[model samples]
Target: MDHAETITLADGARIATWTRAGPAEAPHVVLLHGGPGLWDYLEPLAGLIGDEATTHRYDQRGCGASSPSDEQSVARSVADLDELRAHWELDRFVPIGHSFGATLALAYAAAYPERVPAVGYVSGVGIGDWRTPFRNERRRRAEPFAARLAELSVPQRTADEEVKWRTLTWATDYADLTIGLRAASAMAHSPHVINQHANRAVSFTDADQIGWAAAVRCPVYVVHGTADPRPAANALQLADRLARPRKRVVTEAGHLPWIEQPEQLRELLAEIVQAGRC
Candidate 1:
């Protein structure tokens, strides 16, 4: 059983929380979680790599144990990814992202496919326009969503009260967590990291991400729930425009497919990772 660990970014900010449960020298796989603030998501994912590989999960700054600062940017997060790879002395490794994390992974691979071994995006989102397909569903769903938000304990909530009480849940838990949102919130409490991750993500865009997405030169597989309300469709739209070896769509699941359907998701991911590793 490997243990958890932490690392500091160049800014001297302690921006990571991770778990290592497989062979230390095996293929290194990094899990990029959603929630600009959330980062702690290794527990459930630890099992996937088993003895075959090494897996690490971490929180973005301002979430979990990471110090909060005003230097947040999709570009900075991308820099953080680059920094982590260099810090780990990794010449190449697989990068996987869930929802917002998925988008980041895509952006990362797009920018540095040479360094990224392979990529998998679960319930991925893009940084673009806001869609409230459920705006009225908010009438029917807002109360339940808000109620769920209020139900979270402090560590699970972000630093902001209303977001802790509102936005985080809508973005991550709109479906089911036991496997999804909770996995995402492994970073900061939701109001702080998770909600902030979402707030920053939906609208996050870097000229690099767009250029990178267009130039992604490797295998990219995206898994999303057919039943997933918003991000699911968005995942498909991005997939359509992507180059060959790009897979998009995971049906019969919702936004939290990694947890809602971990085994299947893991199997699908395994195939893509293997292909990329080849």
Candidate 2:
């Protein structure tokens, strides 16, 4: 693994990061991890991108080792990505966004389809006309999570304090279900910063997000799961919207299929990148 070095933004935020196996000359790849404040924790698929892709993984504004959010909001997170791409002068990029990262990637592709090559959208949001379906599926899948969350009370007097408490202790509070995000958040971003970022991310909503995804001309590969509780029907709905040439729905994995089905992910990715424009 080649440690992710930094290219300071004009705003002067020191972002922590690293890159995985690929030559400097190879085509650039930007791997997007979900979990708004989850940090840069996706390492399983980095090696799978092969030699042709120079995979870049970095902490979001307030996650991982990256600089804390400049403004602590979803708009800022999206802006950070845009700013980073501009700063790097990257002509074309392959966005491999997983889970929540998938939603962000779709938003980016929809907003700036010209900057992207193709998208490896894995178990992402249902940004098509499947909001009700996706929402129901999320409710179904998130039930267990929500149940667990319900059991572990936010240990605060008021809703504001609860949010603050969780914001500071998200990694700890949701440690088990989230795979130790508390320590990662603590090590990478502070509670205040993570909470602010979460506030922005949770508040993120755009009716045009789905409209943009529908209008995007770029090819998309959707790797969804059969057993994974989250977004089950939404995946099919999204693929249906894109149709065959630009879509693929994996039947065996769950929310994070890159980790669950790496080979399938690699094959689909290779197919998409090799197929070029639809």
Candidate 3:
């Protein structure tokens, strides 16, 4: 990472932002991480493309090193991104998002089409209806693990217990249990400060909740893992919705492509940035 800083929004919320230096005239690429509340895990991935473009990553408000805030809705998230863009003096750039971040990126593009040249969505949670299918898939894959946890008498009542359950459940997210365990171990040290209030505030009843895919005026690159519990069909459907979309499915990967398929992720991001420059 080139440098890190905290930008205080107009509302007094501070956002932790990082920028990896690249070519001075290169197109700016902002990375949006998943977990409506997770910080920037894409830093390593950012380094992979630092030579090609000016890459940026940040902890959304109330996530990572950023100060906590009661205002954590999707609209607030988009506004914060807009503020970051102005703070960096960027007129337009490419936004690449993962999971929930991908959803937010789409929302941002819909709200400010003129500000985004193109978008890259990886393992993205598409359309509101994705929840049911995702849940069923996750449950099906996690059954054995869930049973084992039950035998161990793991309680799911408290916040800590919920975290433990979620951590263990993450095994279903990867094709390899060892990788899942490693990810869970890393997450154990980090603060899982999710903004439940903000999560409840945003409703995704319709595809138009944010900006419909038809409204996006830029090219969209959609990447998903075949082994990801979240249905691949959602990605294909999302690609169909976008005005201009390119879809790629990695066979051996799961939900966390950066961890399972970093090179492919890096190439896809470079492609998006290069396309934006054209």
Candidate 4:
């Protein structure tokens, strides 16, 4: 991927966006990263599908290199996505969202179904409440690494400390801790870069209330790792609610399937692109 370009939104917030040049007429895909406040970590997955589509990935407003704002909300994030699409001059595109990004993507599609040809929800936070299940799953998986994780999570942390904290916590998101650590290492290092206000605001909002799946007019492809903490049952339920949906459950993967099952993910992405073209 090339260096990011700055796009100033209507509200004057500048978002950092990166695009991988591909065939002019290829399908366009915009990747939404998770963590209402987390930086972009989807570059590896973008690289895997670069030849198939004109890929675009960005640090959403108030995250990574994007300008921070106190007005951050799910509504604002969805608007930012629309702004991005307009900036790219794309009449329609496919959105591939991971974790919380999936929630945002669904919201975007709900608000403007005509702009989205299809969606790829990878390890998505599906409909209904996921907090209780996620907490329980995290505790169950973090038991083995509790001591080390506890030591890493302090009140105030330096950049390296934040990286260690994120790495330790995210390590459980994979079937293998080693792979998880390696994957998490690519995450943004500075805690200062994350907007806690935005994270808290979006977290408290209910994505299901938006009625995005029901409003969706295009095919939705949902992928979940069987071992992911959010639960595969949620994905199944979400697929059932959509107008048209397809799903794949990767047995050995966890939250970040792109890290654990890149080849399989690439194939799934290719399928989504083809489906969109159809």
Those runs of model 1 whose alpha carbons end farther than 4 Å from true positions after fitting are: 127-130, 134-198, 201-203, 206-209
How many pairs collide in each candidate, listed in order?
A: 20, 10, 0, 0
The residue-by-residue lDDT of candidate 3 on 77-125, one tens digit each, is 8899999999999999899888888877888898899999888888887
Which residue pairs does candidate 3 place in steric collision? none
* lDDT per residue (tens digit) for residues 74-128 in model 4: 8889999999999999999889899888887778888998888899888887756
Best model number under lDDT: 4
Model 2: per-residue Cα lDDT over 107-138, one tens digit each: 77767888876777776666444456545644
- Displacement of residue 28 (Cα, Å) in model 1 is 1.4
Q: For model 1, what is the error of residue 215's alpha carbon versus the real structure, in angstroms, after optimal superposition? A: 1.8
Comparing 2 and 4 on lDDT, the stronger one: 4
Give, for candidate 1, the lowest lDDT window spanning 10 residues. 186-195
> TM-scores of the models, in the given order?
0.77, 0.72, 0.90, 0.93
Candidate scoring better on lDDT of 1 and 2: 1
The segments of candidate 2 whose C-alpha lies over 4 angstroms from its true place after superposition are 21-25, 70-74, 127-151, 156-202, 240-245, 275-278
As a TM-score, model 4 comes out at 0.93
Ranking by lDDT: 4, 3, 1, 2
CA lDDT, candidate 1, residue 98 = 81
Lowest-scoring 10 consecutive residues by lDDT in candidate 3? 202-211
Candidate 2's TM-score: 0.72
